[model samples]
Target: MSRPRPRARLTVLAAALLVGCTGSQPLPSTSTPAPVAADAVQDTNPQPRERLRDGGLLRFPLAALPTQWNPRHPDADADARRVLDPLTPEHLALDAAGRATPNPDFVTDVAVSHEGHTVVTLTLNPEAVWGDAAPLTAEDWVATWRASTGQVEGVAPVGPLGWDRVTDVRAGASAYEVVVTYAGVDPDWAQPLVPGPLRASTVASADAFAWASHRDAHYAAPFLVAHVDQAQGLVTLERNPLWWGDRPKLDTIMFRTVQAEAVAAAFQHNELDVWETGTSVDRLQQSRAAADTTLRTAPGTHGRSLHVSRAGLLADAALRRAVLMAIDRAEVGASDLADLHEPPRTWSSNLLLPTQPGYVDQARATGLANDPVRAAEALDAAGWVEGPGSRSKDGQRLLLTFRTPIGDDLAQGEFEVLAGQLAAVGVRLRAVTGEADLTPVSVPVDAFPLARLPEDVASVPAAAELVARVASEVDPVRRADQASQLARLAWQEVVEIPLYQEPQFVAVRNGLANLGAPGYATTDWEDVGWTS
Candidate 1:
């Protein structure tokens, strides 16, 4: 089963091409996360929508075509969530500082009350309507709660930490008014319910969010789903003819799915106007060679970690802990940051990013070290006898694969280092490369940091309680401290091991206004156009 995500946070996305492929999917089903910017976010080329050009085609490249159309579903990757953003209601918008503000287009007013628990009332915008021409109403929110909380059968609620807290959903006065009650004080109440007011009519069944070949959802945003060509691997979005808000600036936005290796070539050949050069020096260099391309740089909102697969040979907790013990995290961190302009820096806690306050080096605090000698001893104690170049236990060789994007030179380099380090400890590593290869042992997380820990970690004693505390804690100081404790538990428990924070690196065609390195700011589709 795919891992459940915490509902209070944004959907976790990979910062690399893994976002599109199977490698990003967790060993079970990958769910990653990013930091919520408590400080100034990496620059996103803020521009006045009025000053941008009126019309142009913004050709965007998605690492892989999005198959899952539902933003709230666990199968939805970064591409799916991003592609769906332009077609969804913006009840709450995250600002540069990661503060949630009510967008007047879909939510006319938001009033919160403290009636013992907590009640949040939302006044729906009468002007907002779905692609099927249904008005945005309270019924939609009620259905969303039912679907999101898994009250409906067969349709799995995407990691429902946020929705699980919702106790009641009913219309206040009219269909336009929505009243919500939560179990406790949720600091980020809007995150879980903001993404959808699922078209209430069709979401009652199991197949509502996903279809086998292609999927499409109802829309209320500035853009309309013009087409989803599964055979062609293209999703085209055009201005909504029924839009009642400000007119969109672009004629259309096309998301073309291409292989990881082909991305640079596509951008250079002018087939794509925007390219996400995910921490790969080779791809970044190649993209810069494109005509009029501008390289946008900012401290990344995402962090990379070493995720251990739960079902493989590494399933033995002792062996899993030994695998982490064998490698030098600092050496791996150096290679990941190599050739980049940002100074070499690695973080130990995924809960609070390095940019946030109350951050701590959980690995050191938990006593995880790069002592291969200790690792070898641990393996020996676990009954694996060390041989010339490998270890064996009951006829099984200590061998594993480190998967990466085929053309990712940076990933390959890191793989080489990881392989060599493990070899010294009598373990052999294989380099596996493919578009959707199944292990992103080293993937960057881009969502709510607190929600990104492997869902299985909750199985550990007090782990579930810690996660709940972190998610519900409203005070910044208390939350950070609670997150610090959880981070320590994640490391000590040998779940997903953190390495460091990555810088947000985006390479886009020059004059592409409002679209580069957005960091914490959500994309404003209507204002994103070329500056002719």
Candidate 2:
């Protein structure tokens, strides 16, 4: 099961937070292009791969490089996923409608049997091979299965929920054919090779699987790792000669690690080719000011969220309820959404976004709303006497401290709004900024919030069980119903609190193709190039 990051500092009554954009063969256009359709799938000037320019350096910036190239490694993050996408073999490909299909480049065909237990048969593409010309076979799947399941000594994967339940991995009729069997019905049977399986040699040793990993994410995709400059925080990928799929459009894709504050300057100075404008009006304005640039906007489920400490000062449910009620979700959303030109959208369920079907907005539900009057009354009933400026209970002032990063002007600004909202309800909110032990987290790519619970916990909320039930249910209608049930339970119990849905705002140089705020659509790296 996935769990929240340990170190914590920081969201809302409902709880929410941040995510976001691009650039550079400058087009002949003299003005910043108008915003594309305000919908889920944002624009990247979508064009055919044959039409895009074949050779150009695509430079971008990364906050940091993945500690390990292995996607299964605990240290690997979304950065690692992005860096490896252009090079790694994908067994499963997601379509425009978010449907998972067997990738013809790796697995040409797939068959799943739900007889007694779940068994998935994958026919590997005969042309698929490793950088060494070694045909990808069942051995790779076996290695992946072993490494992913923490049962193997000295091997630990980040999120191995579905993989851990896999019982066996063996060859089918031929080495190119593989069969995977699970202990029971495997809900995510297609995930055995979702991000692509690892080579047996690369993962045979625990050392290479973890800390000893290099930045070279060598795989048989469209590109290969060219060089890694650790001190300079730069990783470059070049066209892979051994790749059997469509040739990557760019000759080289370079990613340099730069701090958040320096990204705008880097992009403006032409040191960087693309940058995600995020919620920063300054960055958006700068991108709009640049010639031949287009701002792509899309409704996204991803955003920032603050994890409340259940064991801390506000351990009691009453205190937590009061805090939630005291928060003005609209004000918080407005603060985050101001420059993006999006209206404040509030949510109480963690898993269900307003755009999705079966969604129920419980932000204004009875007893759980942004009502300062009700909040003060709840606090008063909880034995916290309201003083002139603050509330005190048992000689202790009712003060809650919120910490944010020193340089994070966005967080600091949001904190001020949140502080003002709470003060009206007589709750003292202390501000702490600097190396906070808080995690400002982003939402999952699939839009489904994973159930974050202790592995050995004796009990779990009904909502968590519903999440599992929904995952296990095979029927579409039944699964949808269970999902609705899960969403209701999640909000009713605050299992995974959600504040607002973040809209994707990407700044791309005009003529760039097949890369933008592609909500739910997998990145087509081979088609990403300049159309000019």
Candidate 3:
């Protein structure tokens, strides 16, 4: 389950290769020339699609990739997993069938200390080289850790303070080692670290490991600062000829940005080889029927929920609860969208694995139910007098301003329906476009008692913690409890009403194999190949 990042505030600004195998069977190619008239064709045999050769080209669809390639920076995660590859990569990358495993492509082995700290040792293919032809080394790993941890200033923006817990990072003669010591017990310590390209010996000689921290000089990963090609609407990726693993199949991975609706059309017309966009159920069903493409469904890290501003009339807890009791969630879930959307039961729907440890069921009982009587009772208790058409409290009108992302048409439609539901209870709901700030007066993630909230509570635990720390009591236990309460309050108060879960749709050309959806926002692009 993934959560949507809050688009309201502008304050915080930011921000892969494969090998060969034994038996060494070549992948069948799918490349073909532009289709010609049936009578004008010379050869009847089907031409193979160009398989990933040492210098072939692959095209991928993108809404946007990161501008910065550095992984340690605060904005790095958005691009690190997709644009910049991870150095100390996770073992088990995706959990599809209850399987937690290591990523064999990048990580060789990992060891954990008694204190629950982890030291990940990485070994790249001997042939692997930096984009600059320098052999990747443990030194590069050390520099990446330093840059991300901000142990050495002048690197990319110092990542969030959470990175400070990394006690030590060292590169050995052979393998790179990263030791992460948590303030408390971190259940997931083996998460991958971003690997940086090796610095030139000349640069290294001048600054040693400190070279990576220098913002002025170009060390490695120059793609971070490179300009986007407006014509292509993409950031072109040239093959790293020095890369150790089997060179990428494509010479250049063309990443193009197109609207979600246009993806299926693009795939049908050969405008794209792969399509990645949040799709609606109707669109997904239509795409799945296309003869020329394959549809892959993966649970995305993006989650969808109704956001309520902490300011305005919604600040009242009683009014918020009244709003929560007015709408129907099941109806929203069933008719929300025609694509791959699911209804969210809690704020952690995107973060907590439903079957994983520490998951509590709080919203199971008070989900979206259409109960005008209960809604009226709650509003009455809050000093609201219900008139024929609307309700008023202390001469103040009961109203709310709802905000959501503009690109999400399905969400926009749901908001319209939700506004109508609230109107029955004498609540005036105004839907605002663009990002609106929802802070200070927000509800918990567990059960929203309020009808609307400002904060976006999704899968990112750190962000959730940040919200919890700021809005609730300050103790750790209390903070965690506050996080849970916020989640609950959102549902219970109907402050932050959940709309639906966004679905990630991947359109692949037929015959592609080993393609997996990104796990927890981390997509391993190296392992996928044309299987034929």
Candidate 3 structure quality by residue, lDDT tens digits, 1-532: 1122222221111000111001112122232111111111111112222343234345666666554444434454443345444222332343331212333333433443323333333444343344455555566556555555545544543322234545666654555443444443332233324322334332233234332222223323212223357666775655443334433444455667776667777777777766553455656676676776777654444445555554567766667667766866555655554444444322333223232222334456345345778887888888888776577767776766666456766656677777788887787766666544221112222111111124444332344654534332212234334445555544554445544433346766775544534323333333334644
Off by over 4 Å in 3: 1-58, 62-101, 114-135, 151-153, 157-162, 171-176, 182-185, 191-266, 280-290, 333-335, 339-358, 365-373, 404-412, 432-495, 519-526
For model 2, residues 397-435, the per-residue Cα lDDT tens digits are 877777676787767876788788888888887767643
Give the Å error, residue 469, model 1.
Answer: 4.2
The candidate, 1 or 2, that scores higher on TM-score is 2
User: How accurate locally is residue 134 in candidate 2, as Cα lDDT from 0 to 100?
Assistant: 80
The prediction achieving the highest TM-score against the true structure is: 2
lDDT of 3: 0.45
Measured over all alpha carbons after superposition, the RMSD of each candidate to the real structure, in angstroms, is: 10.1, 11.2, 13.8
Sort every candidate by TM-score, greatest first.
2, 1, 3
Q: Name the 10 consecutive residues with the lowest summed lDDT in model 1.
A: 13-22
Q: Hey, what RMSD does candidate 2 come out at?
A: 11.2
What lDDT does each candidate get? 0.69, 0.64, 0.45
